[model samples]
Target: MTINRHCPTCRSRQDFRKLNDDEKAWVRAEGSRSYVDNLWRCTAVGCLTYFRIGRINDRGLLPEKFKKEPPADAERP
Candidate 1:
């Protein structure tokens, strides 16, 4: 998912890459949520507006959360 938004400060485009839909507060199962990665900011500088790249997935599958790497100590076992 790509969230494209125009920054009024920089007049540049701020893009955000959406990863998946994860559960969150103020949002229900039927509600919409987006996870963004590789967030990009205006190179022009001065634009504080942050835009997340998000595209609605028409598929039936819901967005899954990103898994963090296991601890190195745990791997020793």
Candidate 2:
């Protein structure tokens, strides 16, 4: 079932659902933690963007050894 969640691209609350297996695999291929995270995708027409509501990257709650660092050449916004 879909739930109401904020869609960053839509800039509004929208319907969202859990990622399917194919979607999860794709996310995993992209090296995203969201594949195993409490991730959701906007279901609004033409807006299938993804977002996460989990603590997968909450460093404060994680051990130092598990913390991840972006690649040196990765650009920061």
Candidate 3:
């Protein structure tokens, strides 16, 4: 399922989808809970940037959180 949310990369509100099982697992393996259930991906063509859905601190804007490859010790999703 997809929902509309603000995408910092797109610099506007865009369609977003939750991370799949494998993607969630990858986030878990990265050892960061910040992006576990809160991460979303922009669905715009040629713009698949991942971002955090929740806010951190007092900032009222959604922050983009790009995904990186899993660590060497971490299993690939």
Candidate 4:
């Protein structure tokens, strides 16, 4: 997959930043107001998905999986 730092979904070079100050304060002591961060738009065309660096946990280090689990009985329609 060709990875582009730019926003492929919006096709816009401008991707907005994010700062969850309210949530961050409640996260931990080390995570203070200075922990403000920037988020990136999805690299998929027309997807328009924006996410933060902390949001990506491919290693499953998160306390709980951010993604929903597939149903065991899911069947092909």
Question: What TM-score would each prediction reach against the true structure?
Answer: 0.24, 0.60, 0.55, 0.25
Error of 2 at 59 (Å): 16
**After superposing candidate 4, which stretches have Cα over 4 Å from the reference?**
1-37, 57-77
Clashing pairs in 3: none
Residue-by-residue lDDT tens digits, candidate 1, 1-77: 55566545445666533333342221334454343333333323223232332422222222233323455786794
Q: Rate the local accuracy (lDDT) of all candidates.
A: 0.36, 0.58, 0.61, 0.37
Q: After TM-score superposition, what is the CA distance of residue 40 in candidate 2 from its true location, in Å?
A: 0.5
Candidate order (lDDT): 3, 2, 4, 1
Decoy 1 TM-score against native: 0.24
Q: Write the per-residue lDDT of candidate 2 for residues 1-77, one digit (tens) a residue.
A: 88886666678988877767766666676664633456676666556466565532321121232223556676555
Give me the candidate number with maximum TM-score: 2
Once model 2 is optimally superposed onto the true structure by TM-score, how far is the C-alpha of residue 25 displaced, in angstroms?
A: 0.3
Q: Comparing 1 and 3 by TM-score, which wins?
A: 3
Tens digit per residue, CA lDDT, model 3, 1-77:
89897777678888888777776776677665644677776676556466566641211212234444446766655
Query: Quick one: ranking by TM-score, best first?
Result: 2, 3, 4, 1
Q: Give the deviation of candidate 1 from the true structure as CA RMSD.
A: 12.2
Cα RMSD to the true fold for all candidates: 12.2, 11.7, 10.1, 10.0
Whole-model lDDT, model 3: 0.61
**Whole-model lDDT, model 2:** 0.58
Q: Which stretches of candidate 3 lie above 4 Å from their native place?
A: 56-77
Scored by lDDT, the top model is 3
